[model samples]
Target: MSAPTLAPYVFKRPWLRNLLNPLANWYANAAGYRKLGLRADDLISEENAVVAQALKRLPMKENYDRVFRLRRAMQCSITHKLLPKSEWTKPEEDVPYLGPLIAEIEAEAKERAQLDTLTVVKNH
Candidate 1:
């Protein structure tokens, strides 16, 4: 990917960044594991569980990480067997992609909880 087109796509809304960061981080870490010559497919169970929990809380139809991975895998298999490359644009798939957003919200909630604890401590 060249810098020109990539840079434009890089600087989007902060809220989206906050939302996608966890999935992005998860992808990055998985890639890092691959770089270290480890197959991370066996590690998907834990991520799958988190993705499942997140989906219940998401109140939306799509979960990017969960759905996208499945789409990519299916596409890979199909293209290699039945489909043509010209016909498969990786299917433009996405999963709930909400893990990062939830983490951020949860962290903020935890901080507020701690602040309330301190306030109670001061009252005592």
Candidate 2:
């Protein structure tokens, strides 16, 4: 698992967030997944159980689109060419669709573990 980020803590401080906002945007764009027509989440490895389950839960249309984008990115990689600027993934279009589901799954797993380890008490 990746180390927990302090991004929310930084973001909660207005001045820090203001200072970092542009830098974050610049870094995101510079990362170049957008140029390949993929969202940031698309770069996430699918080998994780949670992510794999989230992928299965995606709506058919979103799943198809995800596959299409992945294939397009793969093809671009093979050709060593980026998609045209017009075809690049737009910033507005890069929303997370599966993250919430994965979080929910993880929370459920944690809750299940807590329940499993709980000591039951019977009052006389």
Which residues of candidate 1, in runs, are more than 4 Å off? 1-52, 63-83, 86-96, 112-116, 119-124
Q: Please give the range of 10 consecutive residues that has the lowest summed lDDT in model 1.
A: 87-96
Candidate 2 accuracy as lDDT: 0.89
Off by over 4 Å in 2: none
lDDT of 1 by residue, 1-124 (tens): 1013442354576776777777875775445332222233322443454434545665445444445545555665566643344433221232224645446556666889898888433553
**lDDT per residue (tens digit) for residues 21-124 in model 2:** 88988888999999999998888889999899889989999999999999999999999999999999887898888777788878888999999999988999
Q: What is the lDDT of residue 110 in candidate 2?
A: 90
Clashes of each: 6, 0
Clashing pairs in 1: 63-95, 63-96, 64-94, 64-95, 64-96, 64-97
TM-score of each: 0.33, 0.90
